[model samples]
Target: MHSVNTRTLDLNLLVVFATLWDTQNVTRAGERLALSQPAVSHALRRLRERLDDELFVIGRHSLVPTARAMELIGPVREALGRLDDVLQGSTAFSPATAQRKFRIASGDFVEFLILPRLIQHIASEAPGVMIEVVPLPANNALPSLLENGEIDLVISTPVAFGAGLREETVTKVSLLTLIWQREGLSPGRFPLDLYLERPQVMIEMHQREGNIIDASLRAQGLARRVGVLVQNFMAMPVIASQTGYICNLPGPIAQAFAQTFGLSCHQPPIDFPEPELFAYWHARFDADPGLKWLRERIKECANTSDE
Candidate 1:
């Protein structure tokens, strides 16, 4: 690492460097930048002096970047991009006229609960907009994905991070008892003791911590005898319906699934975390008018959406 220079850096010079680095030739970079070749050359000289490094030197046909220039280029470009996003004034995105592809990382449960309504909203409002949903990876990749604009929105429980991301709870859910069928017990409502004593079914969304429900149970000084386990929450209704096993899950989701599958949702015996659904976006998108419009639309979709 070199010593930190106290002299102020020229923000404009960095743009020149980016263009020059991409073109590798002063004349072409100047053309791309709409500046005269000599003007670009003068700017480069100033930049080199300020940074105390020959950022680039002439080759036969193009300028080859030095190690230091390469090191500075990426961070400089990223910073400038962020600054540009910030400088943009607030404007609402109009979905009907807008064309965009919004990526989402979500569980099958979230998709099942929210996507149908979201798609309906998009169809009426953002017909040109596209959607690609990916299963949530068991990692903190959502933050960086948001930063890069790879993913537009992530709806889930809160995750820890600094200012790079913004999160807000859009809705809250209580825990519900999920039971498939009652061989002797008719499916109407479930007893709490039936949940604790009966063999439970669960799946871990985490890659490392096998079963999250089990861990949650242990947190409450209780553990379910997980009889059957599956990874996707969509399968929970199917599995529980046939096997008569009981599961504890988010109340709205449980109610929706239970109503669909001839199962029932009841209050649970023990205290459980109130599962919160969050809507989060990257700070990079804070000023994007189109993104701003879509965020409001999404929030509206969530509010009017059932379950």
Candidate 2:
């Protein structure tokens, strides 16, 4: 292998390389980089000569990356991300005029609770900014997602994250039991006997053994019958309203669903733990002004959610 001289390499070529890797088509890559297709091709040609490898070849519909290009992408992305963070740290982030997109990973519960207020705020204060929210990956993949710059932030219930990640408790919320108004459930605390007797609609996001509610019930030598198991919190309200099943959800979400679906919210019969929603990010981008502003905005939304 021939070692390439870094002094002669143009940093913009790496940018083109990374963008080309993301978008296999040269035309699409050129559009993303705001360069003409010919310019992109010229840069790719220069990069191929400098690296002495055919980094990409024309495929049926797109440019397929050679094995060498595949091996180079990860480190290139990491380096570019680090450089961007450094530049962003030195620049002032004026949300009012800044045109940037933040990618966030979160569950639907966060979407229902925090996003409305955040979007409204952005519309008035940061009209040029964009927000993209994606579903949270598996528990183990979160750290890598943040470290690799795949996601800008994560909003989720408290979970163990790997090293080099920073976490802050955005809000703490207690569980509320949701029941159909037609069931004639009282306005106060739900009865323990009735809670156990009624079939429950459980939100099981992961395939874990049991949730906090189940653990508390087991401590009391009791277990509620899970009549229907679901992977999303959005489904719980509809299921409970139609089937008369009980679902325990976070306070804000429970209230929101109850109001939307004309259900009732009551305190859970068991002693349920108040789960804290956390915002997770990689330590590498700790000084990024845009991300810092975003975190503050999220905290503000969470603080006002109950109000």
Candidate 3:
């Protein structure tokens, strides 16, 4: 491939490239861009000649991207999205009119605490917008997923995400224990001895031991008996309601689960540092008006949840 300065590259060809990449057919790409089929083909030809690569080729009646095209697709789409946002300027966000699908990475805790309220807020305020909540990816993959626009936002522990990402404190959380009321355990009588003596149901979502509470216990040279290990916090209500095992959870989540399952919510025998809830996003989207709107709404919901 011959090297050419990007300054001389026709910007219109990039628009064509992005359209064709999305539509994958010359005619459909032309329809989207309001250009003739020949015009779209001509742009592709010029792009191939200048870049020295067949960016796309016909395969099973669809235009499939070549290796080079695959490499360029992410940047091309991102560039076009940024450009579009700039053209829209401050007029970019109108919640009622914007039909966007925002993907969020979250855990069951945040889902219980914030998602319902956020959905209600969106339904009344931005009926056209949609949200998809996905499970938190492995820590190593989160940064790249945010960078590549695979996910728009993440709501998780403050420590789980860092570097290259922007975050805001969403909630301040403390620990509480959920146990079956049928276990003959009084809320006031859950002292250190009984807290340690019970067979606890530990939630190790993603193979992690419990957080601050567990650490505090270990620091005191104490440990809770593990009766079961489960991946989802949503299961805590059922497990604690039926079994004698106590489940330690974030305060708000524990209260909600306790109410729903007729379980008892108690303060942990040992106090731990309060962990913060946070919402994280890639810095690349800092200037994006639509994402800003979404974040603002989430922040509003988080504030309300804390109340």
Encode model 2's per-residue lDDT on 1-307: one tens digit a residue. 6689988889999999988887888999999999999999999999999999999999998898999997887678667878886765687799888999999999988998899999999999999999999998888878767865679999988788866789998988788998889888778899999899999998765325457788888899998887888989899999999988998888888887797887899998967888888999988777788999999999999889889
Which residue pairs overlap in candidate 2's backbone? none
Consecutive 10-residue window with the lowest summed lDDT within model 3 = 205-214
Candidate 3 on 102-205: residue-level lDDT in tens?
A: 99999888887788899999999899999999998888889867866789999888655556688988777777877777765676535788788878777775
- Report lDDT (CA) for all predictions: 0.72, 0.87, 0.81
How well does model 3 score by local distance difference test? 0.81
Go through the candidates in order and give the C-alpha RMSD of each one to the true structure: 7.0, 4.6, 5.0
Runs off by more than 4 Å, candidate 2 = 1-89, 206-209, 259-262
- Kindly list the per-residue Cα lDDT of model 1 for residues 1-307, writing each as its tens digit: 3455545666788889888877889999899889999999999998887778999988887799999987776577567777776676444577778888888777776776677887988898889998888777544666656765667878776666555677777666566777754544544455656777887667655323543445676787876676876787778778788878877666667877886777767766565566677878876566677666666766676666653
lDDT of 3 at 201: 77
Question: On lDDT, who's better, 1 or 2?
Answer: 2
Candidate 3, residue 83: how far the Cα is off, in Å:
3.0
Q: Score candidate 2 by TM-score against the native.
A: 0.74
Clashes of 3: 0
